[model samples]
Target: MNPLNLPFDSDAMLEGLRPWIECESPTWDAGAVSRMMALAARDLADAGAEVETIPGTGGFGDSLRASFPHPDRGRPGILVSGHMDTVHPVGTLEKLPFRVEDRLAYGPGIMDMKGGNYVMLEAMRQILRAGLQTPLPVTFLFTPDEEVGTPATRGLIEDAARGQRAVLVPEPASADGGAVIGRYAIARFELLTEGRPSHAGWALKDGRSAIAAMARKILEIEAMTTEDCTFSVGVIHAGQWVNCVSSECRAEVLSMAKTQADLDRGVAAMEALQGEADGVAFTVTRGVTRPVWEPGPGTMQLYDLAKGLAADIGFQLGCGSAGGGSDGNFTGAMGVPTLDSIGVRGKGLHTLTEHIEIDSLAERARLAAGLLMNIR
Candidate 1:
């Protein structure tokens, strides 16, 4: 069935998008994020979902788990994944308030995902109005910490995904407007260097520059990048005083690999790294990890299912992997049939210019609803 053939009023979807954009829910702001969850919970309940608010860890706000049962009362269900938090902080809307111009809707979190989150809401709304019964049960998880690596909600996501038939993530579409079929294993690490400090003019010979040591390590890490494996030093901090050889330096390394062998290869190499200079020593600390989500047979089969649904709506759907991690990584790694980026096609996801194509709303809603109803 073509969900686009169903009634989808673009203006009405915007009426829903306006208030959600106005409610800024950054990852760290518990109050703001909880408020956003409350608003979404109300609508989910109105759409006939059984909603539950799970408390977050360490005061990071709460996550919403909403469920809709099939008419036949199925046991296992399909999981719809999303997040309320965004990279933008509070009051960003004051500078870039929600506005639609030239068929583009611009706002904080609009594409990076509140746009995707709204797709789930609007899809459920359409399904409820039509009174269509799903063949399998459905679960929608609105996590609070996806932008920050899903740290707080990682276990929650995995637990909810357990025994589910398939997992679908409504993350933003690819730059080329494709669905996410695979995801790279996200390996984050921090490099810390300690060395001797000395006066630049008089005791320069006594100094062992930590910055110099880190620069060498930086080259070493960057050289590990291959056509299939990617690595980058995203953040670096070194000497503060211009006249002194700094004693400390630090850097954040982000690496991605498509296969487990490559992920292990990169991780082992970093863990074995030591300072090249005698007086300059280094420490490598492993940070958060989202295991690489290589599309399995199950996942590929799910993509074929969604591809057919996209064609039903009059569009060709392509699939690819991303370097960034999502809650889908946890579920996908758990052996569930996972498909991601089934949301609005847009540009500038994490930038100030983030916006979605105004027309993607209707089509993506059609696709999402079709998946929900047709995922038997």
Candidate 2:
């Protein structure tokens, strides 16, 4: 039975989300992100939650954990997880702007997660208002650095998952309103090439072009993409002068693995490519790593439960896979049951066109509230 039938206010949810979206909490801007977290913490507190603040990597903003105790003491419950950071920069709002048109709320971070966060907050409020008795305690973990792979809050998430029944990640749902089941294991890499520099016009033969070597390595790494693994050279930096032979070059490569074993094998292959370029020494430095959330029994169980809840709430639920990673990857990798993309219905994540279906705010809140009160 849907406890929150006609109880959620979609207009109120969007109004509440306005200040948060206007806050502009880019991951790199620590102070800005922290401010955003504070606002959310206050809202959670007002909604009968006790918010705990954990200082994050000094300048990259802090994390928040909000717990609703109520009467469920011995029973374990859900860890509602998400990130406050958006890929958009501080001034992005001036261009993209926040507005409602044709039932879509357009803005930076609106689709990627701000709308989802609002849905979560509203759901909890509805659950409390409905006086629903849940056998489990609901815990909310908001990280400031998930856009960068949760480097600052990975341990925090895993620790919060301890003895919990499940982790619910409210990343934006598919534009078609599908829930996320499995995600590609993700890794970041910085590949650097070192070579001797010489004047391009005078002694081209004497110089070993680091830029050329980096280009070749980028191709080799990009060629590794297949049915199970994806490699992308997202960024490359080399050379200052057009005349001088570039001596130092760097490339930022992102790898997505369909399986953990595939991730390992891909890394080994990339490592082997080091020093393969003539006269260029290669160095590979790994950044953040998130394991694949393979669909296990627990995952499918959660999916089925969600589908049942959706039907009960007067809607049907669909499940899908994601190429990106989030805190869901952390808990899913830890073998704890995790489900994601269970947020506002939206599309164009991390882009200027990012927006969410305004109507889904109420629907998502009802669905999430139902899951919270029912899922074991």
What's model 2's lDDT at 189?
92
Pairs of residues clashing in candidate 1: none
Across 1-376, the per-residue lDDT of candidate 2 in tens digits comes to 3565837878888999999999999999999999999999999999889999988784679899898866775367788888999999999999999999999989999988988888888888877766766668888989998888787778888998877788888988865688988888999999999998999999999999999988888888999899888999988999999999999998898899888789999899888887645788999999889888876788789889888888887788899778888788888878888889989988888889988888899888988887787777
Candidate 1, residues 1-376: lDDT per residue as tens digits? 4455778876778788888888999999999999999999998898888999998786798999998856654478888889999888998988778999998999999998988889888898888788777778888999898876777788888988898888989999888778887888888898999999999998999999898888888998899899777889988988778999889999999888878898998898889895456888899999888998878988888889889988888899999878788888888888898999998889987778989998898889988888887787
Off by over 4 Å in 1: 1-3, 69-74, 197-212, 237-245, 276-278
Model 2 clashes, total count: 0
Location of the lowest summed lDDT over 10 successive residues in candidate 2: 1-10
lDDT score for residue 113 of model 2: 90
Instruction: Show model 2 residue runs off by greater than 4 Å.
Output: 73-75, 200-205, 241-243
Per-candidate local distance difference test: 0.86, 0.86
For each candidate, give its TM-score against the true structure.
Answer: 0.90, 0.94
